[model samples]
Target: MERAYKYELLDKYIDQELSDKERQELDALMTEDEEFKEEVEVAVMMNASFNVEQKQRWAKLLEAEATKTSVQPSQPTKTSETDTDQKETKVRQLQPRTRWLRIAAMLLPAVFALFLYLFLANSSQTAPQMADHYLSNRHQAPTITMSQGNDLSQNWKTAIKAYQEEKYESAANLLEPLTNSTNATAEQHFYLGLTYLYKEKAEPVKAIQQFEKSQQLNPAQYSAEGNWYIALAHLKNDDWTKAKPLLEQIVANKDWKWQTAKEILEEQE
Candidate 1:
């Protein structure tokens, strides 16, 4: 029953009719449950389809009303027997046309609604594929540089090599211990976070934690990249609310990733 209730809440959410507490509950579920998130996505698409259908129906109704008004017999110019005969003939001629118009007006909305539903259903099926492609294409490993006295250890070089070779799990294992060391730098934490993002089974929330730590430790050096990765982490989880502010900040700063961030924001909108 609770599950059924949550499903019903999706409709209220799409309609923007949920109360504050209910909205919070739904948000939590979406964050924690992938299935719930997909359900919400479907609900949103269906709501868009219904909105289109309603608009089409209204347009058809208005057209039908306009046709009816236009076809109303004009006031008789003169009340004479010959004029009466001509007016009767005109009404007879219009009756069949008006009937056909009314029938078309009633049928068109149903036809449009069916088409919209099929189109939206197909789009929903393809959305996940599109998201996967975008993520895979956009998330390239960033290059790293070290100062003369601050050269990275052999382990760090090996980790970097592993990451470049697409062995993200191996890279993450090597970097994990480095992040916990007292001498760990912001760069170390940033790359560790990125490995989590690139791994076959990503851990986005974990990536966000590490990226936040990296930003805090060396805001001057890693701030822009940190913000970009954090936004990507949230995006990976389908948490647009958290990602949007970060993307907006990147765009406003005209940062290195500003163009990509702007494109993402536009797509979301």
Candidate 2:
């Protein structure tokens, strides 16, 4: 009946007073009547007695949709905040590792360079070949050869014999001419000094001069004997200050001369 007379039920539908069967019939009529559906929908909205549950449900749905729409803008902002926090944490975590790696990178090269410099310096300073060369040069014997003759110079032989007999002045007189010769060897200076020592004339100073000459010719040759005799000469002259180093060298030799040199050194001390 409501569908046959749809306009008659409009008031009752707006008032929300239609029976369940009549409401079903009116809904079916409204589906086919576009103008009538619009009229009824407007009237029901204006009516004070519209369906309370439907109004409440529609208000709740609208509020939920508003909340969803409002929250959409904030979602991106929240994502950005989370991303920023994660980035900050990552930067913080990486900073110390980066700093330490930079420091290590800087220091590693310096340490390696320093080590290399030291190694090269030591290698240059202490080269085995250089050391051997220096030792060979320092210990080399002097180029002074004795001339062999069937008729030996009687003056030289007489001086040598006088030295063997401990006749120091006679030997010195004979040896002086040979020492004055430009061709004189270090051995001539040594024998001349021994003559002066035994004669007790210019003992320490003469011995010191001859020892220094021997060292200049050959650092290794007669060094122990020369040093010992120099110390003995200085001791005889009572020059303790000059004698000490030579005496010390003589004592360190650990040879047969050491005992005699030590005894002389003790007497001076």
Candidate 3:
């Protein structure tokens, strides 16, 4: 039952249906259970190995079956006192399992795919699509609050709030003033870069400049994340050549997103 529950969690996760609490529980499992992590990685790659057309076909079938089972009442299975009827029942039981075996036959040799199959299927798809998916799912901006009393400016607080609220233009305007302040730090420029990258009709060029400036000001603190955003910025501009090397660097240096970068680079190739 415990094992079945774990597989249920994986299915919900791959389906993007995991609640926040369940996601945290799964994260703990991944960190503590190597076997489960490996299973998840392979399952993701198998799902991603489907071609675009095949993915859509399978997705529709899966969704339909799931809905049917969930919303419709289950019909009772009647056992007959006949050999022919028993044979039919046995075949019915094996049919779904056989179908799954056929699906697994398409597995790629790789263990993991970047987007849990959301962005793979056709790895050559547009870079901006990939970048947008990654930014939406993978990026997390640190929360800044004045309660800790770390000398944070009001401007920084408001700008981050705007950023969190997805009001990128307001965030950019608020962050601009912070960047001009006497005590401006790398973090301020870093967030401003993020705003420029995400604001309506995004300015990737300006975003790249701000990320670079932030890295130059404090390489030790900002270099890892700075390079990550720069890579995505290049991707947003459809410059795979630029993004490729930065992702490679991330993998080489074992940054926090190294595994994600490695998988993204692998998918493109």
**Which numbered prediction scores highest in TM-score against the true structure?**
3
* lDDT against true structure, model 1: 0.76
The TM-score between candidate 3 and the true structure equals 0.56
lDDT of 2: 0.61
Candidate 3 deviant stretches above 4 angstroms = 1-121, 145-150
Order the candidate numbers by TM-score, best to worst. Answer: 3, 1, 2
Candidate 1, residue 114: CA error in Å? 29
What is the per-residue lDDT of model 3 for residues 131-233, given as tens digits with 9 covering 90 to 100?
7777775345657555845777677777878888889999999888788776778888898999888877888889999899899888998899898889989
The models' CA-based lDDT, in order, is 0.76, 0.61, 0.77
Compare candidates 1 and 3 on TM-score and give the better one: 3
Q: Which pairs of residues collide in model 1?
A: none
Window of ten residues with lowest summed lDDT in model 1 = 119-128
Task: State residue 89's C-alpha deviation in candidate 1, in Å.
Answer: 51
**By lDDT, highest first, what's the ranking?**
3, 1, 2
Predicted candidate 1: what Cα RMSD to the true structure?
19.5
